[model samples]
Target: MTGGPATDEATEPYRRRIAEIWSAALGTPVTDAGHHFFAGGGDSFQAALATATVRREWGLEITVQLLIDHPVLGDFSERVARCVDER
Candidate 1:
């Protein structure tokens, strides 16, 4: 957390993967796993796309609200990982 780039560098692979999906779905550049989805000008439609992306990527059927609750890529990845673990 010292250097800004270092923080992003420390992002988990899953978070990085999800961040890529989010950027593609939202048509914006999202390089940080700690980014807030809605604050980045994302809407419900984009959230849906992101949710579907996650499903395709991890085979996890999660709601858009899950993304809403999780917002950041790292937290979202954690939530999805927990859901997968629960099953």
Candidate 2:
């Protein structure tokens, strides 16, 4: 939430992958990491689906509350990358 979006070379992969998952879950093409998931027609169910997909694909546990906290794709992806790195 501070500085610019939490995106960089390190978090790019997570941004892209999470975007793909979000696109599938929301049934919309998500091209910008700046796009907010909820603003882009996402709901609780879609968030759950995306979260599950992320967990299955990356073996990382991301909660819906986390998603809600970081609704922006870039921010969420950065958090995901951090979680992966921490593991």
Give the top-scoring candidate (TM-score). Answer: 2
lDDT of 2 by residue, 1-87 (tens): 344434487889888889989999999899897999999999999999998998888888678888999999988988888899999
Q: Give the runs in model 2 whose Cα sits over 4 Å from its true position.
A: 1-7
**lDDT, candidate 1, 17-70, per-residue tens:** 888888998899888757899999899999999899888877886789898888
Give me the displacement of residue 73 in model 1, in angstroms.
Answer: 1.7
Clashing residue pairs for model 1 = none
| Per-candidate TM-score against the hidden true structure | 0.79, 0.90
Reference-based lDDT, each prediction: 0.79, 0.88
